[model samples]
Target: MLIGIPKEIKNHEYRVGMVPASVRELIENNHEVIIETNAGIGIGFSDQDYIAAGASIEDTAAAIFAKADMIVKVKEPLAVERAMLRQGQILFTYLHLAPDLPQTLDLIDSKAICIAYETVIDTQGRLPLLAPMSEVAGRMAIQAGAQTLEKSNQGSGMLLGGVPGVAPAKVVIIGGGMVGNNAAQMAVGLGADVTILDRNIDTLRSLNIQFGSKVKVIYSTLDVLEAEVLAADLVIGAVLIPGAAAPKLVTRDHISKMKPGSAIVDVAIDQGGCFETSHATTHQDPTYIVDEVVHYCVANMPGAVAKTSTFALNNATLPYIIKLANLGYKKALENDQGLLEGLNVINGKLTCKSVAEAHNLPYVTAKTALAI
Candidate 1:
């Protein structure tokens, strides 16, 4: 199989789909790999690096798009790259289609085998592919929110872990999943007053056990959420609903009533956002003021740490890529129930029920779509 890796074109996105070592693994499997020239350059892997790993480099993304059997990418293809998609070409990437209607429509028209990394499941029913990035984004949320708290950024100017003589900042994280858990870990390590809220009693219990007296874990309810946001110096929106749009837990009214200079990091911005006022921002301009509350809602937060993110993501995705290349997508998807969950679109049909319900479109089971 011929696999292609295109340089990520999203704003401030520097991670490559496949690194040199990842390419070498595919090459050893007798697969041909092509990458756009300098695709890994931002992550410090030069074109020569990929070449040395047995990958052919193309001068333009157009050429890579024109030929490869499968297009491995780091982010959802932008408009231009989406236009280049060929029917039946395997697109294995993070396609957060639930919130982007135009992308969903374009993908349907392309009739490609769209395997979304974000929706892929593991044997334990966990999102294995999405977890790595979630971990990165979650940890970064604290870093970004702390920066946003500086007076220079129009934030409330509160230090995350205040001086010994001063009280530590109050950090409130919504959701107790991977993102929330990681965020809480960072915040607690910084000696901040950290609190995590979730609807799942078991998750809350687990978090309580994990943090003990160092952090607070609470049951999530409307009143509890409102109270926490009003008191928090930094609020991290980390909730997720698998492939569906994130629920808007923090309303506009919640933003207005928050103390002036307070900051919010909406880590769930990729799946729409849990905060009503959150809009996707780029690293170049990563914040906006909403009712005196600073909003940090970069959709690709992990992209800010390109090298770490690329390597971590590659570690998780490479085995699946190998399977698709060696066994062919159909056989691979058929053999792995978890991989079949990754199928969003194939042969012009919507195979992901979440995406179909998001757009109120017709849906078919992956098996039905493939006539397996």
Candidate 2:
């Protein structure tokens, strides 16, 4: 099998798909790995590193795509990259198709075997490929929120931890999942009064056990969210709905009630955001004022730390890439239920229910699609 690794071309996306170690693994399996020239440079891996790992460096993406059977990538294909996709070729990447109709249409038209990393699930109901990036984005959510709190950034000139005579800032997190947990951990460590709300009582109970007196766990009702936003100096929206779009829990009307200068970092922006006013922003201009409320909704927060993100993402995705490469898409998906969940589209048919439902397209089960 011939595998290709392309440099991520999304705006400000510096994370590459495969690391040197990943290339070495494929080489050890007797698979040929081709990496586009300068693909790993943004993530601090030199082309020489890949060459040392037995990967041949191609001068152009077109060259890599032309010969490789499977293509691994960090992000969903952008318009230009989408145009390069070949029919029946395998694309293994974070294809968040629910919110992007154009991307879904492009994949369908290209007739590629699109296995979305975000949709792949383990038996534990956890997204294996999406977890590493989620962890990075979750931790960074707090770091980004902290920076946006500075007065110059238009946030309520408040310190997260506050000084001796002053009260600490209020930090409200919208979900109790991985992103929310990490954000809350950071907010609590900074000595801010932290409150985490979730629709799941079990999750809230778990958080209560973990944080004890340091973090407050609350039932996430509309009234509760509104009241919390009114007092919060920093709000982190960490809600998710797997492969589907995130529910807008915070509305523009709710934003109107939030205190002026309060900051909101919507970590769920990749899944179309849980905040009504949210739009995909780039790292260059990450924040905007909505009713005087600061919104940090960069779609690719992990891209800001490309080196760490690339390594972490490869740690999770490399094994799956090898499976698809070794067995081919059908045999691999047929054997592993978890991998089957990753199949958004195969040879132009929509195989993932969430993605098909998102666009009202005909849904085909992976079993049926693979049979063809």
Cα displacement (Å) at residue 144, model 2: 0.7
Per candidate, the number of residue pairs that clash is: 1, 0
Cα lDDT tens digits for candidate 1, 1-372 = 999999999999999999999999999999999999989989899999999999999999999989999999999999999999999899999999999989998999999999999999999999999999999999999999899999999998899999979999999999999999999999999889999999999998899889999999999899999999999999999999989999999999999999999999999999899999989999999999999999999999999999999999999999999999999999999999999999999988888888888899998999888774
Displacement of residue 293 (Cα, Å) in model 1 is 0.2
Against the true structure, what is each candidate's TM-score?
A: 0.99, 0.98
Using TM-score, give the best candidate's number.
1
Question: Which parts of model 2 are misplaced by more than 4 Å?
Answer: none
Looking at model 1, residue 195 earns an lDDT score of 92
Alpha carbon RMSD to native, model 1: 0.7
Candidate 1 residue 128 Cα shift, in angstroms, is 0.8
Superposing every Cα of model 2 onto the true structure, what RMSD results?
1.0
Deviation in angstroms for 222 in model 1? 0.7
Residue pairs with colliding backbones in model 1 are 156-261
True lDDT of residue 238, candidate 1 = 96
**Local distance difference test scores for all models:** 0.95, 0.91
The positional error of residue 312 in candidate 2, measured at the CA in angstroms, is 1.2
